[model samples]
Target chain A: MRQDIIEIRWHGRGGQGAITAAKVVANAVFKAGYKGVVMAPTFGTERRGAPVFTSLKISREKIYDLSPIETPDMVVVLDHTLLEEVDVTHGLKDGGQIILNTPKAIDTYDFGAHKLSISDVTSHALEAGLAPGIVNTGIIGAFAKATGLVSRDLLREAILNEFSVMKPEENARAAALTYDRTVIGGA
Target chain B: MHVIESGNVAAATGVKLARTQVIAAYPITPQTPLTEKLSEFVESGDLPAEYIPVESEHSAMAVCIASSTAGARSFTATSANGLLYMNEQLHWAAGARLPIVMCVANRGVGAPWTVWNDHQDTVSQRDLGWIQLYCADHQQIHDTVLKAFKLAETVSIPVMVCYDGYLLSHTYMPFDVPEQEKVDAFLPGFEPTHFLNPEKPRNFNTVTLPDVRPDLHGNTAPGYMEIRKTLHTDLRAALSEIEKIDGEFGEIFGRGGEPFLEPYCCDDADYVAFCMGSLSYQLRDVVDAMREEGIKVGVMGLKVYRPFPDAAVREALSAFKGVIVLEKALSYGNQGALYADVKSALYSAETRPFVHNYIVGLGGREIKTQHLYDALTESINKEAAVGDEPRWIGLKL
Candidate 1:
């Protein structure tokens, strides 16, 4: 891995829109002038409610490697329930950031030597009048606040662009609300 | 306009820009989104073309053949078993000399039934007489598709633009979509020399005797063997046309130069990694790592596969000390198809490099950079002693 590249792994259920979320972030960051951005979903046979993951990589130069990211700088959990069955932190870097869409407090989880951020994105999505448990856009707000890789405005714009026909304003609002409610904890 | 989109959307955008007259495709995994997007484009009036929702891949191809034979520019797409189902139509499209274009989201075939990325589908159809072009990224997916229409129309042979099923098809990346006017300038309307006309009814692909015979007007016509020979000769001639069209595309779009082979850092290296599709791009990372460790290595991507580009392959690779041929498909019992081709191409060269084959990532298996690095390093260390037997990487049998 290049030192300048930031790799992220997103964990969620098959129907939970993790792949779309990664794509949104990739779009936002690419608009932010990171020239190289790639988002790839786990290949083959994804069933709804079954655990699925997608990887995103961003860098200044063009990225040629299409291989899955073995060690990610950040791990995003779209559904906290996935944490029990899936080790979302399997190959996370030592000081990596872990963002979770959980109702629990950040201190309740102990990920050694890494930063933690928590946002109840499911609640945020509901509050924003989105479908129940559609926390994909909301999690992007937490990601923006925790890593500062992309701006909230840019993410909101990307969400609107991606969901233009399906409640674009509501998804942008969900992302904004989740961004404000995201709590970041020290390593 | 610059946008971040999937490789399928990129291909569809190219089709729309080319102003395709008709599109007929059956829904299949990976390739479904491309045709679905094309349907959306047609329904939304973003593209004024006829969109046919066919029952099966065979019917989809049949629609293309019929439409193309009527002098309408047509397109279709398929993958895995879907491509296999259209095997007979594939040859018919070529032999009948229809200028149709199809995109193959390359996937592994099955009795095991897998919907994953591999080259088995297209590689198995290598002899079916379609011009095969492989894309390594989203931009190439868009660019190659646009170029394929021109090449196919120029040679009167159907073209298949193939890219890895999930790797490139599903992944989202940034690519510049060329302006419609510019694309129009680069590729003109399809004007076939001969097409079906209702006023003057003619027979196409009718059964013929083994020996040459005279037609109703006493004009001598070619026999079956001669017709087959013409197709072979024309396919060989299309190689230069491919290069010329690519050069013209580059002049207009400013994004192409290497038409047949896209070589990265091979000018000063002694060893090069060779493959088709995304694997060649993936090996770039391994090449970088090896370069840092004092190993002179580069990677070359075979963009045009069917014409084989034997002369180009020999010319580019003859200077290297070793060529590591990594592929996602195999010939089952013999060896990697690309490995055999590389060796055969290098057979007449005064100095032949040690060519080794490593089959990797069949059935969507994870292809790690570390494994590729290890394989290339081992091959380089052993040099000519790396034997002729094809090696398997990341195997856990």
Candidate 2:
């Protein structure tokens, strides 16, 4: 793990748009002036409801290392059930952040020394007039609010850009609502 | 405009900016998105080109051959087994001297049924007489595709713009899309020297006798063997033309200079790691980490693989204390293809370095930075351990 690059691992199912969320975040961060940003989905035959993961790396300098991240600085879980299906906390650095899309309170789960942040992104998306289970864009809002690494406006802009032909306004609203509802807890 | 997008989109944008007239391809993983993007551009009327949804990779290349011979700037893309399926047309395309450009999202050849990134696909097609160019990142994928069209037209040869499948193809990164006007200025409209036209009817690649024969004008026409020799000679000569186009392209795009080889931290290093494609970029991080520990090592990426850049390779590697040739493809019975080539290139040099071969990331096996670091460290310390056989990394068996 290079000290200069921040590595993030994203967990979700095949059709949950985890890979799309990773790309949107990479775009937002790059536009926010991070010179180097890379997002790569796990390579394989992906089936619906199958456990899958993707990685995102961001840095101020150019990134030449394309190897899979063995130890990530943060872990983002798009579904709370993924915590049981997969070891979402594996290879997470001590005191690293775990941003989860869950309706439960942060203290409900014990993640050891890692910081925990929870947001009901699925609920937020549904409340914002989006179709059921469309929480990929809303999850970015939770990431932004929890880490404060990227601004909300930039995330909204990226969301709109990604979903321009689709429900762009609904996606942006879902992200905004999630951003306001994200709760950050100490390690 | 600079934007973060998939490498497939980057390649599509380059093809659009080049104003390609015809595109025909069969969908293959890692390469399907590139053609899909081009099809979108065509359907949306963004790019005015004929999009042919061919049934197979063979037909895809045949369409390019027919279109290119008719003086159309043609393009296509494919992956591992798909590329192998077009083997016959690939030879015909080069032998007939059609200036078509194809993008190969390099993938592992299948037997156990895996669609993953590896160099086995293009490396196996080394002798098919196509000018092969490897890219290390998304920007290079865009830039090289544009340059491939120009270089192919200049030499009257087909070109394969190759980058690692899934590694570069599916990854999202930032790359600048050069303006259409700038690309047009760099690459003029396709005016082929010889083409199939109703005004000037002539046969191309017709059968000839074994020896020299007289033509209609009583001049000696080259026989079959002579034609092959000419194709060989011209392909070798195109190496210099490649350098020239690279120089001119750099002057226009602000991203050239290293036409055949892109070196990093090799100015005063004793050891150099050599490979093709994005693996070279990955080794750059290893080189930097090793340099921190007072190891004088660097990395050199071989961008142009066909016509074998022997001179540039010899010149860059002859002065090093050691050279590690790490690659994804092997020659099966002998050693790594790149390792064999590098050794042969340095054979005639006055001073040769200790070159070792390492095979890694076959069939999309995970390539860890730690594995690379350990391999390099061992190669540096235990030079006595070097042998004719290539060492395999991450081989659980």
i-RMS of candidate 2: 1.1
User: Which pairs of residues collide in model 1?
Assistant: none
TM-score of predicted chain B versus true chain B for each candidate: 0.99, 0.99
* Tens digit per residue, CA lDDT, model 1, A1-187: 4677899999999999998899899999998989999888888779999999999999988888877888999999999999899999999999999999999988899999988999999999999999998999999999999999999889988999999999999999999999999999999
The DockQ for candidate 2, computed on C-alphas, is 0.79
Off by over 4 Å in 2: B383-386
Per-model TM-score, in order, reads 0.98, 0.98
DockQ of candidate 1 is 0.80
Which TM-score value belongs to model 2? Answer: 0.98
lDDT scores of the candidates, listed in order: 0.93, 0.92
* CA lDDT for candidate 1: 0.93
Please write out the lDDT profile of model 1 over residues B187-289, one tens digit for every residue.
9999988789988788778898898999889999989889989999999999999999999999999989999998988989999999999999888888889
Native interface contacts retained, candidate 1: 0.81
Q: lDDT per residue, candidate 2, B1-397, as tens digits?
A: 8988888888999999999999999999989899999999999999999999999999999999999999999999999999999999999999999999999999999897779999999999999889999999999999999999999999999999999998999988899998888899899999999999989998887877899998899999988888888888988998999999888888898988898999999999999999999999888888888999999999999999998889999999999999999999999999999999999999999999998989999999988887888888888886536578899988999
**Candidate 2 local lDDT, residue B78:** 98
Clashing pairs in 2: none
